[model samples]
Target: MKRMIAALIVAGALVSLPACGNDDTNTETATRTSNTAESTTVQISSVTSTADLGMIDQAKLAAFVVAFRTAYADLSQDRDDESIQEIVFSSCNAIADGATEQEVTKEIRDLAANDGTEATQSQAEQIYKLVTPACP
Candidate 1:
């Protein structure tokens, strides 16, 4: 199923993120002088941090939201934008943390189910399908 494939892909990507390394670096130099006749030069260097790359792609996230809302208008209409985003991010985080597809599906399902109406695996699958594309 699409859900299973998406979940597996997301899970794999997440599990591998920690093992990846960023070797890109940047260096800058600044010079300053004061009336006291003292001059100072400072050199700063930084490497791209994993945290910088850990975020989900914004465009993809937006697309996912649109797709989700279209697919599940009734469910999405009840939640605000922030709430939906939070759910997607939470699901992505779980995948990154090495949770299996079933685990991720169950988590989102439980969260959805708590909001007055019972949630189904199919709904969870749709959520997972929509969220996986947004993961960084």
Candidate 2:
């Protein structure tokens, strides 16, 4: 899950880079991307044989992943860690950007629906609870 989350953050960072424009938002985006890359490297080295991830504290992210796996075993068993991480981290980012719990839950539920799985509001709330403290 951490791997997935990291991957998503990295991808988002890359995509957020400025395009042929010199502006504060562009500079800010570039700085954010750089920081994200640095964090990802540090995070990857800290993990033992786990997938490289970016943003958030890895240990806490792992705990969230473990709990998520147990809570949604049937839906998550076949899903790769990276993808789950992506979903979780995306939600984490949203939370950081001021999205409400209900909004996050709806987003998570929607993501599950894409996999043909029906995720409960409680499950979504679990994600909010676990990722909130870990989000940087």
Candidate 3:
């Protein structure tokens, strides 16, 4: 189901990218893309295979997770610029601490690939709360 949803989301992004040139429509596209990514299931257990993932840095990992959640929240709330900016800002600490966006994205996709859609989303909300306690 997650794969199906993700596929749908990618399709939406693809559809929106060239379909409209207006900023308002682009914003909607961005929101749609952001929502799709946020709704996409992620697994945090990518660190289990040390050889595959290398030595996991917990702080960087945390930063990525928090950034991931913040992006979703910002987009869903209709704050387009903030949504886009926060993703970069929120993940900066992790990136500086040695986390690459590719690494984080790969980990998330790996986790998403392994879990049930509903369960993964539920877990994501829980993880979001844990990572950004002050937000809620």
Candidate 3 C-alpha lDDT tens digits along 16-132? 454577888878877876665444312212312222222233333334333443434422243333332233333333444576655434333333232232224444343333333
Note the residue pairs that clash in candidate 2: 1-85, 4-82, 4-85, 4-86, 5-85, 5-86, 6-54
Task: Supply every candidate's count of residue pairs whose N, Cα or C atoms clash at under 3 angstroms.
Answer: 0, 7, 0
Poorly placed runs, candidate 1 (over 4 Å) = 1-54
Lowest lDDT block of 10, candidate 3? 41-50
lDDT of 1 at 10: 63
Q: What is the lDDT of residue 113 in candidate 2?
A: 47
For model 2, how does the per-residue alpha-carbon lDDT over 1-136 read when each residue is reduced to its tens digit?
Answer: 6554564455445454454467877788778767876776575556423332355665566555665665567658677675666666667667767888888888877664436677778766666665676567
- How would you encode candidate 1's per-residue C-alpha lDDT over 15-128 as one tens digit per residue? 344444443311111111121112111100011222222355544654565555565666676776656666666777788789999999998887655356656888888778
Candidate 2 backbone overlaps, count: 7
How much does candidate 3 score in TM-score?
0.23
- Candidate 1 lDDT: 0.58
* Structure candidate 1, residue pairs in collision: none
- C-alpha lDDT of all candidate models, in order: 0.58, 0.63, 0.38
TM-score of each: 0.57, 0.56, 0.23
Task: Report the number of backbone clashes for model 1.
Answer: 0
